[model samples]
Target: MENNSPRQRQRRRRPKADVAPAPRRAAPVTGRLRPLSQEDMARISEASFDILHDIGLSDASPEAVRAVVGRGGQETEDGRLLFPRSLVEEALAGLRRDFTLCARDPSQDIEMTRSRVHTGSGGASPMVVDLETGAYLPAMLADLYDAARLVDTLDNVQFFSRSMIAGDMETLRDLDINTAYAALAGTSKHVMTSCSQAEHVRDIAGMCFLLAGSAEAFRARPFLSLNINHAVPPLRFDPEACNVLLAGAELGLPVMVNTFGQMGASSPVTIAGCLAQTNAETLAGMVLAWIVNPEVTAIYGARPMVTDLRSGGMAGGSGEQAILTAAATQMAQFYNLPNSTIAGATDSKIADAQAGYEKALSVTMAVQAGANLVTQAAGTQAGLMATSFEAYVIDNDMLGAILGAASPIPVDAQTLAVDVIAQTVRGEGHFLGHPDTYARMKSDFVYPAHADRQAPDAWLANGAPTINSAARQAAQETLANHFPSHIPAEIDRDIRSRFDIKLPRERMRQA
Candidate 1:
C-alpha cells in the first residue's frame, strides 16, 4: 500500500498511482540445472541411471510395456521395477522448452512458457467428511465437476493443478482417473496428474503419457504433472514413495515436491528455522532428482507455515505464511528454479472477512515475492478440511489483479515526468493533467471494492455473501464458460479406456 500524502504530493505531484513500475524481475523458471561441476554432473548422472536399474517404479499397469524394462510384466503385484538407466536420460533429451496444457475446454488452454504462472483446481477431494449427516462421505462428484469447469474459466490457472479429492482411498484410483478424464472431457484441455497414492500417481502419469502419443509425449509436451507430497521424515524421503518420484522423473514427467512444515509440528517457532528444514528437504529432492535425471524439471516447492499445535492442523491467517512463501521464492530464485507455494488458502471455513483477508494477503505476497505457480489458490477452509466454491471464484478475480502486478512498467521516460517539468514554469508548477496522465494512470491501478473496504452498509447491500457464495458463483460462472477442443476421437477413447469408463456424449460434442 503506497502512501498518498499531500505534503509528499506538493513536493512532487506529476505521477499518480496509475503508473506502472519498470519490469525489474526476470521471468520465473523451472527445471533449471544449478551450476554444477562436470564431475558433479557425472556423479548425479551416474546416480540417476543407477536409480533406474536399482530403484524401479512400482504399480505401472497399462500393459504399458512390462516394467521399465518392457518384459518384467506391468503392475508388479510385489512392487516391480520398470524404468532402466538409459530410458531416464533418453526421455530427458526430448523435453521441450514450453507446452500448452489443454483445458477441459480448448478455450482454456494454458501456455506454460513464461515464468510466474499460477493455477489450481479441485479445492477439496471427496474425502470422508463426517458431516452432520454421517461418516466417510466422498467429495461431491459435482464438486469436482464444478472444479474442472472452474479450472476452464479461471485465467490464472496455468495447469489444471488438482486441489481436493474424495477422501475414500479404496475408490481413489477410480476417482483420480475419473477426475482427470472428467477435466479433460468437460474442459477439453489436458488435466494434471495429481496428489494421490504412489500407484495412482503412476497411473495418472501413464494416462498423460498415452494422451500425448507416447511415453515421451508428455516429456516433450507435458500438459499433465503431479505432486509428490514429501513426508518430512526428519528431512528424508520415505524410501517406499521416494522411488515413485524417481520413476516419474525417469518417465520425463514434471512434479511438485511440496515439503510442508507446520509451526510446532515439523517446524520450529521461528520462520527461518522452519524454512531451513523445509528447504533442505526440497533441495535434497532436487539434488536426488538431478541424480535421477537432471532433465526431470523439478519445481522446488514448500508450504512451511506455522501449525496449530493444539489442533495439529495448518494454522492459516498468520502473517508468517506469506512471509515464508516470499522468502522461499527468494531461495528458489537463488537456486535458479521456479518456486511453488500457496495462494487463496485460509483456515476459515466460511468465506467471511477472515477468509478474504488471509487469502488475499497470502496470495498477493506469494505472487509479489515470485512464486511461479501458486498451488492452493482457491478453496481452502478449516485447515484445508473444507472449501468454498465461491472463494475459488473470487480467487480468480484476485489473480487477475495480481498477474497485472507482474507486468509492472519501469523506464526513464515513464518515471521521468517530462510534461510535469515543462508545465513547471518555476511558479504554479503541477502536472495534474499531464498529457501522459491518462495513459500512465491506467497502467498500474488495482481499484478498491466495498467489501475489501470497511464500508458497513455497502457490504450488506452487495449480497453480503460469504466466500462460499462467491466461490459458488465463481464455480457456476466458470461452468457457463466451458470451452471444448478437437481432441481426436481415438485419443479421447484411449484416455477413457484407462478409466474403464466410457466417454459421455457431452465430450464428443466439445470441439
Candidate 2:
C-alpha cells in the first residue's frame, strides 16, 4: 500500500518555478537554399502526372493488376497498369498527413505534424569500422545492438533506423527476429527495419504485439513500421517488395514507399526529368497502398540518387546529389504527405576531411529544405556499404549543429537587451561577467559535446585530442554502460522461448 495522506502529498509537490515552463529560447534560423518557386513546383507536378497517364508502369502483382483495373485504371497488352490522372490524385488526396510514430516508451513518440525537421541514423551497411584499430570488419549482430544503444543516448540522433546488417545471421528468419529484438532491447526510441518476405512482417508484428502486452494494444499504438522499397525505378513493381508493402498495409503499419532511381541511367539525365519520373513512380506506389487498405499511413520516400557520368557508379556524396534530394523534399510537400529521404551517406571510407564536408553539405541542405525524416544521417560511409562507430558519435554532434542552424531564432523587444548592454558597458566594461550573459548561455548558444573549443595553451596542455579520438572515447564510454531495461524479465523469457533470438542476454549487461 502507498501513503496518500495530505502531508505526504504536499511533500511530493514540486515548487511552481521548477514545474512551470521555462522562458522561450531562441533557435538558430535559416531558409531554403535556392528553393523551387510555386510555378516550378506546378510544372513538375503536371509533368509527373503526365508520365503516369502516358508512359504507365509494368509487371505489377496480380493483386495490383486487379485493384488497378477495378479502380478505373487500364491494363496494357503486356500487363502493365496505366493509372489515370484521377486515380493518382485520389490517392494523394486520401493520404494521412498527421500521425504518431510510437516508441516503446510513450514519451519517446515522434509526432509527424511536420512542425520542425528531425535528423537520425539510417543505413544497411555490411561492414563496421573497428573502434580500437579504425579498421573495417564484418558487422555482426552485436554491432547492431551496440549501435542501437549508442543511438539511444545521443541527444541529436532522435530515431534509430536499422543502420547496419547483421552479417553473422545465416538465415533470414533468425536475422529478422534478432534484428527486431536487438533494436527493441537496445533503445526505446522508434525503430524502422525492412523485411525480405511478407511472412516476416507478421512475425515481427507478433513480436511487437507481445512487447505491447496484447494484439489489441499493439494495434492501438503500433511502435514498429516497415520501410518497403515498393518499386524498381523506370516504372516497375518489384514483386517481393510489393508483397511486403501489402503485408504492412494488412497489419495497419506505416509503410515507407521508397522509390530509388539513378539519374542519367534509370531516369533522365536532367534534374526535372528525374523528379518527374520519381514522382510518378511514387504516386503509383501510393495507389497500390490505398488499394490494399484505404486507411494505411504512407511515408513519401524520395531517394533522388545521382550517378557519376565518368565511372557510372553512384555519386552519393556529390553536390548534385544534395541539390536533387533537397528539391525532392519540396515535391513531397506538394501532395501534403510526410516525407523521408537520404542524406549524409558519404562515399568516403573513413571519417576524415572528405567525409566531414560530404556529410555536412548534404545534411545541411536537407535540413534547410525541411525534410520530415533525414535518413543516412549518421554511421554511414563508403556509399552506404559501411558504418563507423566513431563517425556515428561525430555525426550526432554535426546533426545537433545542423538542427540548431535550422531552428528559428526570435529577435524581439526583450531579446534586444538595450538595458543590459548599457549596464555592462558602464559598470563591468565587458559582457563576460554580466548577469544577462550568464542567464542566456544555455538559451542562446548551441555547444558540441565532442568538439574541442579550447585555446592553444589549454588545448596543448590537454594532449590535443582530435575529433576522431574524442568521438571514439565517447562511443567507448556509452557502450560500456547505458543498457536500457524497459522490457520485463518475464517477457524476455517468453520471447526467447518462442523465437530464435541469437543475441545473448548476458552480453547486454555492463562488465
Candidate 3:
C-alpha cells in the first residue's frame, strides 16, 4: 500500500516542532533618522552658546538666580541672568545622561537614555469629544481619569500624561491635585503633570508619600514627574514655573523642562535662528536644574513648534512641524541629554484622513530621529486644542506600526532558512504548513485591532465599518467596562481624607 512516489512522500512528511513565540513586552526602539549633519550641529551649538553668553534669559526666579549665581552665573546690567559658556558647559557635563522614570507597577518603568524612543499621551486640551454624542464638551476630572484608563489599556502608548485640562475645577490648586490623583488612580504607569504652585508640588509629594508608605519609599521609586514649561519663548524664564521646578528638584522628582518656541511668532522666523534660541532656552533650564540638584533626572524638552505665516496660528500637522521636531531631537542628542519632543498634534478637528497623514508623518519622524520621549503622540486633535477618546484607540494602532518599523530586523542562520527553502523546493513547493510560520506569526507581525484589512466581500458583510465608527465602538466598550483599581481602597480613602480629592470614587467604577 506504499505509493513511494515523490508527491506521496512529501505529503506524508511531518513538520518540525512548533516553537512558542516570545512574550510581548514594551521595549525602547532606537531611532535611525538623522535630520541634522555634524556641521549643522556644531553651528547650532555655537549659536546657542553665544545667545546664552550675550543675550541671557530675563526674569529668572529668585531661587534660580541664587542657585545659578552661586555656581558662577552672572547678572547682566539690565537684571537678566547671564550664563557664561564655561558654566553652561560644566552643567552639561554634570547632567544625568540616563535615568529611569519609575511606575507604581515596576513592569511599566521607562528607561530614558540615548535615542531610545517612547510615545505617550500629552496636552492640556480644554475640550474632549463626547463619546456618546460626538460634541465638544469642556473637559472634566472624570474625562482625565477615563483617558488615563484608556491609555492604560493601549499597548503602544507607553505613559499617561494629563491630556486634557479639568475645566470644571474651581481653582488651579484643585485642578493640579485632581489631575495627578486621577492619572495615578487610573493607571499604574508613570505620570507626568504640571503643578500651578510650589506648595502644590509639596502637597502632591505628600500624597505620593502616603501612597508609597514613606517619603524614602516614594523617593526610591517616584511614580510621578513634573512637566514644567520653565521657559517662555523670546528668551525668558517663566518665574512661577521656575519656582515649581525648584520645588520638584528639591524633592528629587524627575522633571522635563519644556521650551516651546513657535516659529515666526515667539521665536525667530528662520529655522536656524529658531533652533539656536530654543537650544539656548533648554540649556538654561538644564543649568538651573543642575544648580538645584546635580543628581536630579532632568530631561531637555526642546519642543520647536511651527507657525503658519499667513494665518499666524499653530500648524502642528504640517511637514515643517515634523522636520522641526525631529531636528530638535537632534539638538538634544548633540548635548547628550535625555530629551522629549511633541508630535501627533493634528490640525484636523476630528480623526479623519487629514489627521491620519499628519499624525503619521510627524510621529514617525520624531521616533525615527530618536526622541527619547514623544509627547502628544496620541489622542490630540485640532492643533492640541482638543482630544478624542476614539482617537486614543485609533492612534494606539498607528503607534504600534510605527514602533514596529523602528524595531530592529534580525538576520541569522535560522531566519535565513536555507535548508527549509531547499526542502520546500524539493517537496511541497511552499512553506505555508511549516512550523516556522506558526512560530513567527505573532512575533513578526503587528495586527491592528481597529484598522480594516478584510477583502471587499468580507468587509461588506461586516457592514463596511469606518475606522472612526470602530474606534468609537471600541472606546465605548473600554470606558463602560475597564475601570482600573490599582490603588487599594483603604489607601485611597486615606488619601481622600488627607487631601481634597475631587474625582468621585463611584465614577472610577463601572456603572
lDDT for every model? 0.55, 0.82, 0.88
What would the TM-scores of all predictions be?
0.67, 0.92, 0.94
Q: In model 1, which range of ten residues has the least summed lDDT?
A: 1-10
With a 3 Å backbone cut-off (N, CA, C), the pairs that clash in candidate 2 are: 28-407
Tens-digit lDDT string for candidate 3 (1-511): 1123232233224232232323445565675888789899899999999999989999998888898888888887788998989999998999988788888989888889788888999999999987666779788887888899889888888899889998878898898899999999988898999998999999889889989999889888889999999999999999999999989988888899999999999999888899999999999998888888888889899998999999999999999999999889999998888999999999999899999999999999999999989999999999998989999999998998998888877899998999999988999898888888888788888888889999999999999999999888777767666778889899999999988988877667654
Q: What is the number of backbone collisions in each predicted candidate, taken in the order shown?
A: 39, 1, 0
Candidate 3 residue-wise lDDT at 273: 91
**Tens digit of per-residue lDDT, candidate 2, span 232-277:** 8888888778888888888888888898999999999999999999
Lowest summed lDDT over 10 consecutive residues: which window, candidate 3? 1-10
Sort the predicted structures by lDDT, highest score first: 3, 2, 1
* Candidate 3: residue 287 lDDT (0-100): 86
Give the residue spans of candidate 1 off by over 4 A: 1-137, 167-172, 186-191, 195-202, 414-417, 420-471, 480-486, 502-511
State the TM-score for model 1.
Answer: 0.67
- Order of the predicted models by TM-score, top scorer first: 3, 2, 1
Q: Which ten residues in a row have the lowest lDDT in candidate 2?
A: 14-23
- Runs in model 2 with CA error above 4 Å? 1-31
Error of 2 at 40 (Å): 1.6
Instruction: State model 2's lDDT.
Output: 0.82
List the RMSD of every prediction in angstroms.
Answer: 12.0, 8.3, 10.9
